[model samples]
Target: MSASSDRLPLIRLEALPAEVLVDLAAGRQPASLGRRCEEGALPPPEVAGRALRLLASGVAERWSLPYAMIDERGAIVGACGFKGAPCLGLVEIGYGVAPLRRGRGIAAAAVRLLLEEAVIRGGAHRVLARINPDNAASSRVADKLGFVRGEVALDDDGEPLAQWLWPPSTDFAHDGEAP
Candidate 1:
């Protein structure tokens, strides 16, 4: 396991090379890096496809922006990161914890660490996360991290989604209001 000072265990996805991503997408773990393929450690097929497309298009500067969430024993428990680099000062963040690791605050810790990185190192002024309305656990993680719940909307596929923003703002009508 790589030594890190943060309380939560995380490794930036950018640290891994393209070959590692290809291996991960193929359900293989880079054992040399001490990575383990727990449930959900690798992105789903669709997400992986998009990542590959982004890589091929040369617009993937932030394609590897995610971090691998690790457990106390150094096994990857999940993944989290910005969808891409900050655009217009806003960055979208996403995370997923293995089913076995749910309810353990792993998502929250990973989000917090990413938030710190975005603001301090990436010059990001805002962070956003879109969650499915039925995803109560994800909502809880956002709430725990002080993300203000915004309007309810539909995603590209017409799925109900709730928009959450971090570093709570007072400008929006939903700001400072409880979800």
Candidate 2:
């Protein structure tokens, strides 16, 4: 069922354990969230599976860890985070929203939070949002955040994807961060 949502105050980035990730991936209401899953809050199997791989292969550091996107009402509406800790001062980011939660500025806001976290922790000098060429929505989110285009590269499975880079000096009109 669809739960109440406001575009909203701001989403909290909660660090979840691997077990909880598994639970969310399987469409279960993970106890860590302290609330029931919204209609599309749970991550699909594929997304959660990728996160597991990243966590294991990247030896997730605080800056590169996965996070649950908890809305103001405490329901998780998305999953967002870095692919792994920074390497050579660069890190990749990814985010996904629930079906019912898309088009509400949630992804953009989640991305902003990820960028802020990376900056705050001082673990990454450059943040990259690598997205499939066809993913226009993600491209818009990156653009909204002031990301500039970079060279395209293949992912782990050799799929070519566009790279959007966030320079260290990003201002992004940060008068207020809640989007």
Candidate 3:
């Protein structure tokens, strides 16, 4: 494994720091960052708190791993990681990079790292994601990660949404191996 993968670069949900948790709960991070981390444009402590609770309860196998794009000085760029249990044969990968970090391929890198973790530590058999059809960048991230169309669901607004899936046996271009 690469040194980056050796450290298991992705932070586990239980390991999130209190300050970072507070920032996430306080709406301090940008919506774009929060969206990638929490799947919404707005920061809602109740929502984050609830998600964290689920993670703690093991109802959700994993949670957001916030990563800085370049270094400590980088803006709270975004978070990427898996959700659900590997033993369940289902692991969903999601991510959001700060708008400022867009076009830099940071989200793709983060997802690749997470997929490696899922394979190495979690024994994940499959991975999944859902994206808004209109978010071209997100769709691209999924595609670059080797995700393919899986299913469609209707949002609360009755808009059609796309679901993407990745087989753990499939090869990832960035990692150069099956996730």
Residue 42 miss distance in model 2 (angstroms): 3.5
In model 1, the worst 10-residue window by lDDT is 1-10
Candidate 3 local lDDT, 1-179, one digit each (tens):
11133422322222344455556677676434322342332224644564566556766334443333332332334555454455466677666665655676666766776677677676777777778888899899888778876456786789877777776233343433323
**TM-score for each predicted model, relative to the true structure:** 0.79, 0.75, 0.65
* lDDT (Cα) of model 2: 0.72
Q: What number of backbone clashes does candidate 1 have, counting pairs of residues 3 or more apart or in separate chains? A: 0
Record all residue pairs in model 3 with backbone atoms less than 3 Å apart, i.e. clashing.
Answer: 36-96
Per-residue CA lDDT of model 2 for 1-179, tens digit only, reads 12223543377778767887777568676676567556765666666666777777766546434677888777878778777777788787888888888888888888888887787665677888888888889988998888876556687899978778887233423421111
Error of 2 at 140 (Å): 0.5
Displacement of the residue 155 alpha carbon in candidate 2, Å: 2.4
Clashing pairs in 2: none
Ranking by lDDT: 2, 1, 3
Candidate 1 off by > 4 Å: 1-16, 23-34, 59-63, 173-179
Candidates 1 and 3 compared by TM-score, better number: 1
